[model samples]
Target: MKKLIKKNIVIATHEYATGFPQHLRSYLSDHSSGNVLYIHHPLHPELREGIGSGYEWNSGKKRISSRSTRPVTAFGIAFFMKSLFLDIWWTLKSGKRWDAYIGVNNLNALAGVVLQKFGMVKKSIYYTVDFIPHRFSNTFLNAMYLWIDKLCVKQCDETWILSPRIREGRHRVLHIPSSYDRKQIEVPEGIWLSRIKQAPFSSVSPHTGVFVGVLLERMGLQLVLQAMPKILKKIPDFRLIVIGKGAYEHELKRLITQLGIQKSVECKGYVEKFSDVEKIVARCAVGFAPYTTEKSGLTYFADPAKTKTYLGCSVPVVMTNMFHNACDIE
Candidate 1:
């Protein structure tokens, strides 16, 4: 009898709870019969538990601590070093050579690059989900980040960008070097499509609006809040439902109280399950993706999972012009 070989695959990512990483995990778990090892920097403490064959490094605390400018740059350096050390440690401890190593961001991709160079991993894949030039407040640090990103893209066997806008705008315009031909760089239509539940389209009440995903400053929940009074003028019974949590939660709540629109908005906090989020969104009249254009360059190119989730629930989206899909809404 011939023995079946299980290819060893390693995935290193800074985010695990939501967005691309979560969908990637689900897809790999379902489709691949190989032994998959997930090395993730847990953004949420609750998601520290390993998924599939996985390991967690508490990258969340570092991010939370690095609120200031200097500390943010320091955190980036620390993250790169920590990820590299963890990758080396895992490679040594596992005793099995990795057939492939997939990195979700520049920091994690640095680790994959080193692993591939050392012959610990046969192939490397750099997944570019977001491209923000000024991610770090310090100019030097931001330049360093860009250099690292370029190196990751150049060294990796395959590069996968989330949106066509990014592939066209950043990759083509910036002229990043790649190993493979056109087939090497792939732009997937939707990362979360497999996990999305197919349900009948249900019309929502005109006065209700729903916003789902991470409640960050760039997400433009504040814009939604500011527009609430105007929306109320047109539709007196307008109510907005916010489902997610982030650093901007306190500010959002404060704004709600200050605007005297507390009764008109409901902050659902973080829903543990995506199914629950879908349930809440399904009852709303329109889905909101009011991302701020000035906040980040990545916003213009990002294929936000929240948009997909909203559409999956059959909710009409009211997003800003920054998003690539926003043009298609009309």
Candidate 2:
């Protein structure tokens, strides 16, 4: 057997516990030869140091404790402003030139480009998860976001997108033509080998379903709750297990109580590992991913990661036609 050659690689993304970043890390660990450094931008302003908050750093197999960010507002404007600067600053301070620098979101991608400018990174990759023009409510902020997105697309050495529709949308909406075609656009899709191994056989709960995704309103989780009352009438012992956390979690719980389905539905908050999610989902009869079809939402363009995870678990997935893979699901 030949020995694997190591590459110095770094990744920057928001500390969201979404499967994408973790999957990226796990995928590289298994296939690529590299020393990986992962950095995160905290979503909330009140992230603490020791609580395993998403803002911490992990390099290779070792976990490195990082200092906490100062508080301000939700989504923390300061974090957004400083994320790119710090990525470059940290790279320069390391006194090392990275073989590849991958940034998950547009802001992080911009950091990768800036690192390349400073000669700190050999290659800069723009790994965009989703793209929507009206992502922010503020007009100025939304415009700025779009500008940064276009800049990253033009500047980065490579752009890794989730779906092909996103590629079309960028050209149609942003008027940015694809220069390299196949070389420029790449889709890194695949669950881990264990997920590919398929979940173990278990006693399926016929009247029970599981939800393992973000709790965002556009994710359409509330619709399932609204319809659950009717579902309860059919299967009196019907149950729903909701795993994952997001902005809509409070509203979801409130709606559950409002619908008087508290005993019927269980909110498991956030699960740290997809394997743990599989443990809960594999035992269920079906999985749910009722995302909305709103044009301004990420669901309209990108395939839902939760739905893919559910499919990997070998459980039936009930999803809306708002995502890219809806037509293919059948």
Per-prediction TM-score, please? 0.81, 0.88
Candidate 2 stretches with Cα past 4 Å from truth are 1-5, 30-33, 44-74, 195-202
Please, what are the lDDT tens digits per residue for candidate 1 over residues 1-330? 011124566777766346666665555655555666667654443323332223632121221111111111223466457656776667556666788888888777778888888888898888888878677889898888888877877788877887666656555545764433453465544535444454444555667889987777888989989888888888889898888777788899999999899889988777777777777777777899998887347787677777777877777888888877677754
Candidate 2: deviation at residue 197, Å?
7.3
Instruction: Report the poorest 10 consecutive residues by lDDT, candidate 2.
Output: 47-56
lDDT of each: 0.69, 0.75
For model 1, what is the C-alpha lDDT against the true structure?
0.69
Give the per-residue lDDT digits (tens) of candidate 2, residues 193-267.
565545455577888999877678898999899999999998999999998777778898899989999999998
Instruction: Pick the TM-score winner.
Output: 2
Q: How many backbone clashes does candidate 1 have?
A: 0
